[model samples]
Target: MRLSRFVSAASAFLLTAALALTGSGPAHAAGPVYVALGDSYAAGVGSGSYDDSRGGCYRSLRAYPRLWANAHTPSGFSFTACSGADTTDVIKRQLGPLNASTTLVSITAGGNDAGFVGVMTTCLLNSSSACLRRIDRARDYIENRLPARLDALYDAIGSRAPAARVVVVGYPHFYKLGTSCIGLGASKRRAINDAADLLDTVTAKRAADHGFAFGDVRGTFAGHEICAGPAWLHNLTLPVYESYHPTASGQSGGYLPVFTAAV
Candidate 1:
């Protein structure tokens, strides 16, 4: 009887061990799963040395996501962010990588929906009055229509990855605090920066409403903007595809540190 009891006890211990190994025991048994989702900024558009496997997504090895992943070594990582992706694109294409298993998520979005590219182009190529009008239009859209869209997106993300710690990353102003060295008028420079600030403000509030952390990058890029002594952002690329995106140094130094601290 003693021997039989001992065998049964040993069998139970082995079964429990097997369950743990197979990740069927409890939450503690599962490994970390990280998912990155968003648009060009999240995809490292301006950072050189793109990953060919990701095609037009323009993901760079030196991007903040990869940097953070390298440092943490999560059990699984899915980087689905793509260049030129808007919020709608994220809802349709990017969210596929997230699920109940996701423990971490990072996103940089809403700029496209707010017509960031168009605003920048108008400001760069058009008259100051035209630029201000464009900026006002974008600002109105951000204040009036953006909040609801953001709320829905945040809700969708939360529902899909209920347990994940979501980090909403914000964009930086392109110019230094009071300097516009790229031939842009002072008012135009200030307008552009103010637009960026508004975007971040709206993004942060929406993130807070959903209980997600907003990773503000304005301070991170303070002295490294386009007009700075040693700029961290690309000025304007000939191909146009690489224009105005963060440099590799920006990703490694500016974004990585802020994201690391948030996560």
Candidate 2:
């Protein structure tokens, strides 16, 4: 009877150990399912080393989403963000990756919708007055038209990924003020920075209205703007397609830290 009892106890212990090793134990749980969505910044446009699989989207390994994923090791990760994507593109195309199973979502958008590229181009290639006019136009759009669009996007994100923590990341000022820089004057620099600030404000307010968290990255890129000694953002690139985007350092240093803190 004693021998029989000892054998049964040993068998039960072995079975429990096997279940633990196989990850079938009660303590075992799946990691978070993270989905990254937005535009070029979130896709790491100028960070270099694009994933060919994603094609024109220019999803880079050095991008913040990848960096965040590497550190966190979520059970599943879907990086659906593309280059040059606006809020409309996100609502139509990017939302496909998100679903009921998603637990986390990170997005950096609205700059494109506000015609930021046009503002930069006018400032860089045209007269100061022309730059101001373009800036004013963009700001008008941001104030008059962007709020409703942002509300729609935020609401859609919330509805689609009900359980996910949506983080709306904002853009940084391209130029540092009160500093000498080539190709752009101080006034132009200040105007562009002001526009960025306004964009962040609108984006943050929309996120809050939807009960989503906003990741403010303006302060993180403070000393590392285009005019910095060693700039974090690319002033220009050979392809020109990569211009004004974040460098690899910016992705790893500027964006990663702020995003990490928020998450």
Name the top TM-score candidate: 2
Report every candidate's CA lDDT.
0.90, 0.90
Q: Compared with the true structure, what per-residue lDDT tens digits does model 2 show for residues 90-140?
A: 999998878899999999989899997898889988999999999999999
Clashes of 2: 0
- 91-139 per-residue lDDT for model 1 (tens digits): 9989998889899999999999999899889988999999999999999
Instruction: Write out the backbone clash pairs for model 1.
Output: none
Clashes of each: 0, 0
Regions of model 2 farther than 4 Å from truth? 1-25
The CA-based lDDT of model 2 is what? 0.90
Q: TM-score for every candidate vs. truth?
A: 0.88, 0.92
